[model samples]
Target: MLIENMKMAFSAIRINKMRSFLTMLGIIIGIGSVISIVSIGDTMRTMFADLYKEVGLTQAYISIGYWLDDVRQSDYFTLDDLERVKEVFGDEIAYIDSQSYVSADALYGRAKVKFDFQGIDYNYQDVQPVNIIYGRYLNEGDVKGRRKNVVMDVKSALQLFGVENAVGRTFRTTIYGSTDEYTVVGVYKKDLSPFQAMMMGQSDGGSAFIPYTLLTWPNDYFYAMRVYAKDDVNLDDFFGRLKVFIGRLKMRDAEDYYMATAVEEMGMMDSMMGGLSAAVGGIAAISLLVGGIGIMNIMLVSVTERTREIGIRKSLGARTKDIMIQFLTESALLSACGGMIGILLGSGLVSAVGAVLGVTAVVRPSVVLLAVGFSALVGIFFGMYPASKAAKKDPIEALRYE
Candidate 1:
């Protein structure tokens, strides 16, 4: 009986092919939009997770809140404090360093190019490593001996010396009102993520790296420190205690210090992404309601056009339940077919966008199933009125109609 009803439904749909397609248009668009948004959101989340993994989840940052008016220079963590942290938390810490930057003009021969020098210790790379194309990174000897050697990106090297490999070359720059020449020990390539590249704009000059010991800015006080914990350590707990320990060293309250971990950052980003996706997805879903209304209107027209047919079926001993089920099934099949097509369209969209963004698109099976089920439910809910109206028509009245 169910198979017979489906066949009848298919026959009716085939008879008015164009109208059926027009009616299914709404469902197709609604499901497609929702699927695309969901798949992209999932893809971004996956990309974020991969990025965090590459940066290491055990990494964290600590900074002094100098924005407070009462905050003094003495409140800043010093080189001694940095060493003390290493001494006390030696077992838990994998790498630690103080981060500072200086802006200066690099003078090589007749050329004067702008460059920002990032001051870091030997352990800095272990926490946030970089790609070195030529020469080697900073060593313990460089930091301990206060060597004026530096590592620069390929872009800056070309701008300064007109060459990609500026190793064994020297450029003069002023630091703290004193002029000195610094050698380029290494050259590296700059790497930025797709999202980062979009958000960041061009800078006045490229960036280079130097030993922290050489950057003596107003008594060498640092406002920030970067630390990476051991893989086996719990990042939250370790940072929590480290904050307190630093607070004690500074003779200040723990609340005065600020800490940021990759784990917390990852969670916050995921939440933000999820909320944005939901908000946009909800807006897109309004189209599905419009589609459902379209279905209802077309079903009413179908019933009216087939009144004589309905009457004949009733006269042939067809029950009212049979009439209702037949129309409902037809509506459902229409919506289901539209949903399948929408899925294909959405998959194609994901592939294109993912290729451009360099992220692997993630389309979950559960999401697909939910979209299909909801579309069918929309069909049944909207088809109720038309199906009921058709089933309740008096056989004598329907048979007399044109």
Candidate 2:
């Protein structure tokens, strides 16, 4: 009996195929937009997670300075401070590295490239490992010997020497207005993301790393200290201890110095992405309501057009429940068809967009099921009024009028 009702419902839809298709259009567009946004949101979350993993969430950065009206420059952290942090944290701390930067221009023959010069300790790689494609990274001997050796990222090497393999190549740069020559000991692969590249000042022209001892900056002041904690260490607890240590060392509050961890940074990005997805999804959901309204309007018109048919069926001993079921089936089929098409459209679009953005698009099975289920619910809710109206119609009056 249910199959027979569905057949009749399909027959009705087939009679006005164009109108039925137009009615399904709203649902198609609404479901497509919502699913696409959800897919993209999931991709962004995955991308951020991968980035955090690559950078190491166990790492933290500490910037030392004095703040009056604005931030005021002070002396850089000493090796003693690094030792003190290690002593305080003990086994919890894995490693500590410091880096400072200076603006310099590299000149190799006629090719000249301006870059942000970084002075880093040998342990810098332990905190933020760089892939050495062409030579070796800095070593303890290099720092102790105060060797005039430098490591350039691939981008910088190409800019300075017009080649990827730039090891042993000599480049002259003005350090605090004094001309100094340095040999490139290695060429490291450039950062993959724009954010990471910008953080290292590699996006603006290029950047190179040198031994901290070779830095001519005033009185050995460093820009920032990077601390890496053991895997078992809790970042929140570690940060609290660091804040206390900084306060005691500076003879002021811990808030005086800027301190941040990769975990905190990743958390912020997660929150931002989640909020964006919610806001976009909410906007897209509004279209579902509009689609529901369209379904209701079309169903009402269908009931009016089929009033004589409803009268005929009633006269032939058909119950009001039977009439309601038939119309409801039609409405559900229409919505379900739209939803299925929307899922295909949305998934295809997500894959295409993800390829362009270098993010892997993931459309969860649960999300697809939810979309289809919600569309069916919209059909039932909106179809109720029209179906009820048709079921309640007086057979004699409907036949007489039509």
Candidate 3:
């Protein structure tokens, strides 16, 4: 009986192919928009997760700055402070390294570029390891010997020397007021997160890393310290101890300095992304309501046009419930077909956009199912009035109508 009802519903639709397509238009646009936004949001979330994973979430950062009356005071971390952190954490700490930045201008023959300079200890790579495409990274010998060796990011190397493989090449740069020459010993791949890019000023800016020992500035001062904890250590316990130790050393409140773990940062980002996705999806859903109304209006017109047909069916001993079911099935099939088309359209659009943005578009199976189910519900809700109207028509009255 159900199959027979579907066939009759489909036959009606086939008879008015153009009108049926026009009615389904609204559903197609509504579902397509929502699905496309969802796909893009999921892709962005995945990208952020991958970035956090690449830079270990177990790591923490301590910036050397203090606040007084809501005003921030720039300060620096001393070598003594680093030693105290090590002594306090002991076995709980895996490794610690300090880094500072300076602004300098690099000159290689006629080509010159200005960039932010970074000074790092030998153990810096142990905490934040980057891929080395050419030559070797900084080692204990370079730090102990106070060697003026540097490692440049691939983009920076290309900008400075017109080639990514600029290993063993020397460049002159002015540090403070004195001019010094440094040899590029390695080229490292660059992968900066949005926060890191903003902090570093430019995403593709020319920058180089050198051993802190080579800098003439007081060895006691550093801009920030990165601390990595052992895998088995309890991070909460470690952070609590660190706060107390820093408080005693600074002779002030532990909140004076900014201390945070990568995990905390990632959580904040996740919440923000989730809210954005929900907001976008909600806005797009408004179109579905409009689509439902369109379906209801068209179903009413169909009933009015087929009044004689309904009367004949009733006269032939057809039940009122049967008439209602046929109409309802037609409505559902109309909406379900639109939903299928929208899914295909949305997925294709997402893939095209993802290719342009260099990201892999992600569409979950659950999202697809939800979209189809919601569309079917819309059909039922709107189709109710029209179906009831067709079922209640008196056979004698409908048959007498033109």
Candidate 4:
């Protein structure tokens, strides 16, 4: 009997092909919108997680309290101070370096190529390893001798000298307001992912590196240092002890110091992105309610049109429950078909956009299953009133009306 009812329902839909298609449109749009949004959000979250891992999720940043009113020169961290911390921390520390930056133009003949110059210690390479393609990274000799030497990206080297091997090439640059000639000691290749490259765009000039001593000479101090803890170390406990250690080292209170970790930053970013996606997805879901209402309206119209058929079925000894189940099955099948099409359409959209943006397309099977289930439920709930009306109809009156 159930199979017969489904067959009849399918026949009715096939007879009014155009109207049936029009009725399914709302469900398709709603399901498609939700799937695309959720998939995109998941992909973005994964990209961010990968980025954080690349930058060392276990890394911690320690900086001096320059914001405090009582801040003095003693509050500043010097090379001696950095060394002392390293010696004390020993095996617990994976890598440590003081990173400082200055924006300058490297004069190569008539062209003044711009680059962000970073002052880095010997241990800097260990913290953020660079792939040296042409020459060598900065060594202890470079830092101790305070040589006016630099390392740059292959792209930057090509931009400056129109060649890949720009090592031993001299360029004039003003550092800390003093104009001096600096020699390129090395050239490194920057490997960026497809998504990262798209975000950065096509840039000719890139970052250049130099010995920390050359930039911070005379005073040789820094306000902040980037530290990486070992994998085995507990970040929370290490940072707690580090803050106190630095505070005591600088003759300041522990509360005066400020420390932030990459893990904390990643967590905050994930939370923010998740919340934003949920809010936007919720707004998009309003279409589902609209689609449900459309199903209800159409079902009501269907009941009115099929009144004579209902009366004939009742006269043939069909039960009221039988009529209701048949109508409900028809509505559910209509909604389920729309949902399947929407899933395919949404998946295609996600792949196309992900390709264009150079990010991976991620679609969860759970989300697809949920969308199909919810759409079917929407159909059944909305079809209730119409089915009830059709079931409770007076057979004589319904037959006489037509």
Best by lDDT: 1
Residue pairs with backbone overlap in model 2: none
TM-score of candidate 3 versus the correct structure, residues matched by position? 0.88
lDDT of 2 by residue, 352-387 (tens): 888877656889999899999988888888899999
Cα deviation at 54, candidate 3, in Å, is 1.8
The pairs that clash in candidate 4 are none
lDDT of each: 0.86, 0.81, 0.81, 0.84
Evaluated against the true structure, the overall lDDT of model 4 is 0.84
| Residue-pair clash count for candidate 3 | 0
State every prediction's TM-score relative to the real structure: 0.90, 0.89, 0.88, 0.92
Per-residue lDDT over 148-217 for candidate 4, one digit per residue giving the tens place of the 0 to 100 score:
8999999898888889899999999988889999999999997878776654453555678888766663
Model 3 stretches astray by more than 4 angstroms: 64-66, 69-75, 144-146, 162-165, 176-178, 190-202, 213-220
lDDT tens digits, residue span 199-222, model 3: 336644587788865553444466
* Ten residues in sequence with the least summed lDDT for candidate 3: 65-74
Of 2 and 3, which scores higher on TM-score? 2
How many angstroms is residue 76 displaced in model 3 relative to the true structure, after the best TM-score fit? 3.1
Cα shift from native, residue 185, model 1 (Å): 1.3
What is the RMSD of candidate 1?
2.5
